[model samples]
Target: MRLTRHTDYALRILLQAAVEPERRLSIAEVAEAQGIARNHAMKLVNELAGAGLLATVRGRGGGFALGRPAGEIGIGEVVRLTEPDLRPADCENCALSPGCGLTPMLSGAVRAFLAELDRFTLADAAKGTRVPLLIPT
Candidate 1:
């Protein structure tokens, strides 16, 4: 399944945090690194923080960090959280919606896709990667 840009950015943000676990990162840094808008990054960061995937701090010298270890964060979990809809096909609007075998097949495909992603964690994706993923401010 093709992921939405939102999910893609969210995953990038998580990977950035995973890569720099020791340092708190700002939305501007994430936006610059991911080539996304600052406001978009801020919204995604806030959503992630609300989900307990990221920890945010306020006031001067404030930033964000991974709420838990990278290894503890599942790639599938992130996708599920960020993806508003997982249905592969719009079978509901099809003329054959009443008895369409494709619907079940598509649903199974989505489940399989998620299951494969569930096998990997943020640490797994960030493994062997350096801080070069993020641009210096």
Candidate 2:
């Protein structure tokens, strides 16, 4: 199954923040860097902050930064929080819901995917591309 755009954006935001742990990034900057809409970035930042993955500072010279250490936040945990539902298929209202085995198979696949993600954390994800972004902090 494919991840939603919202989750994709959320991950991007987390990665940027994690890469620069000392600097708080504004939504506008994140939006510009990720080529996403400002409003969308704003919403996702709020969600991330609410989920405790990001910490926000209000007023002038304020923005968002990682709330917890990148190594402490698992990729799987982020996926779980960003994704509203993990169901592989919509079987609740399907005519063949009772007999369809596709649901279970898909569910198993999703579970496996998440389990694999659990092995990695934001720190792991950042290590590959963060060298250039590091601010020496």
Candidate 3:
């Protein structure tokens, strides 16, 4: 399934943090590096911080960092936390929830997708990129 732009930006932010763990990063740096809007990155940073994906500091020299180690953070968990809805389709609107052959197969597919995501860590995401955009602290 395709992730929304919000989720995409959230991933980018976490990946950025993973790549540059030495110093805290500002939303502006992340936005500029990823060619995304600063406002968008700010919102994504807030969302990621809320989900325990990253920690935010206030006042001078304040910025964002991973809430936990990069290897400890699972992409599936991030997706679960950031993704607005996990459902592949509204099984509620679908008449298949109770008992439908199609429902089982579709649900299985979603589970498989999540399982794949679970195999990767934030470090994997960080290293997966060809050239990481490392921002200064």
Candidate 4:
């Protein structure tokens, strides 16, 4: 199943943060690095912060960083937080919905997909990635 842009952006944000565990990154920095809009990055960062996946600071020299260790953050958990709908198919409007087995099959597929993601952490995803020099303003 194709994941939404929201989920994609969220993962990108996490990976960027994971790349620099010691440095706090601003939304603009992440947006520039990920090629996403600043507002979008801000929204996702706020959401991630709210969920305790990211930690945010305010005022001068304020920015964000991973809330916990990279190894402690599960990729699947991030996906679940960002992906509102995981259904692979829309069997609800189908005439054969009542008798269709596609729904359960798709559900199982989604489960399997998430389960696989659960096996990896942000650290796994950020391995060998070069950390850019971003001086927070």
Candidate 5:
């Protein structure tokens, strides 16, 4: 299963935030660091904040930070939240829908993949070490 760019950015964003729990990062800062577009970063940041992964503060001196502790943020949960759809295929409209076992098999594979991701958290991604965040302080 391939993750969307959105999910990739979400993980990158979370990792960056987790690396510096005390610092608030702006979308521009993150975009520059990750080599992503500012608008894309902004959209992902807003969605992440809405989903409770990150906290956003407005106005001067306001920026983004992880909403919860790194250890508490599950990678799988983030993937599930960020991914638009997890279906392996549109079996409902497939020509072989009548007798296809592929859909069920594919769904099982997706479930297993997600279950594997559930084993790790943002803290795991951060490796429990304080790394220099992509966002400049």
Candidate 6:
């Protein structure tokens, strides 16, 4: 199952913010640091701001930052808010919803995916040793 670009960028934003709670960041900063497209990062940043995940500031000495505490945000919630729905493909949502055994299996897998996501929070992403944050300190 492939995640939407929005969801992927949202994760990037949150993880970027988590790395450095000492200051506010901007979509530009995140895009440059994460090596993602600036336009895409800006879109994700706006969506995250709307979702109350990050706060934005204007002007020279301003940027963006995490809206709430890191530990208070859940990975699953981010996915849910940004993704809207998680289907392996649109074909899964076709008229086959009535009696498709594959649907049930995929449904179960989705549940499992969400359950796993629920197990982690922003803190997990921030402190993760595998993919460290790229904050400017």
lDDT by residue for model 1 over 1-137, one digit each (tens)?
89999999999888889989988998998898679999999999999999999999987788999999999999999999999999988888899999988888898999999999999999999998665455545
Please, what are the lDDT tens digits per residue for candidate 6 over residues 68-102? 99999999999999887787656545798667668
What are the per-residue Cα lDDT tens digits for candidate 4 across 1-137?
A: 88899999999889889988778899988788778999999999999999999999997789999999999999999999999888877788889899987788888999999999999999999998775566565
Ten consecutive residues with minimal summed lDDT in candidate 1? 128-137
- In TM-score terms, candidate 6 sits at 0.84
Instruction: Give me candidate 2's TM-score against the actual structure.
Output: 0.90
Candidate 6, pairs of clashing residues: 25-64
TM-score of 3: 0.87
Clashing pairs in 5: none
Q: How many angstroms is residue 71 displaced in model 5 relative to the true structure, after the best TM-score fit?
A: 0.6
By TM-score, the best candidate is 1
Give lDDT tens digits, candidate 3, residues 1-137.
88988878788888888878888998877788888898888888888888788999987899999999999999999888878887677777766677767777778998999999999998988885643465555
Model 2, range 4-106, lDDT digits (tens) per residue?
8988989999999988887888887778877789999999999989999999999888899999999999999999999998887788989998999788888
TM-score of each: 0.94, 0.90, 0.87, 0.93, 0.91, 0.84
- List, in order, the clash count of every candidate structure: 0, 0, 0, 0, 0, 1
| Residue-by-residue lDDT tens digits, candidate 5, 17-131 | 9988878998888888888899999999999999899999998888999999999999999999999998878888999988987988988999999999999999999985553
List ranges where model 4 is wrong by over 4 Å: 131-135
lDDT of each: 0.91, 0.87, 0.84, 0.90, 0.88, 0.82
For candidate 2, what's the RMSD? 2.9
When sorted by lDDT, best at the front, the candidate numbers are 1, 4, 5, 2, 3, 6
Give stretches of model 6 more than 4 Å off.
Answer: 89-96, 129-137
| True-vs-predicted CA distance for residue 85, candidate 4, Å | 0.5
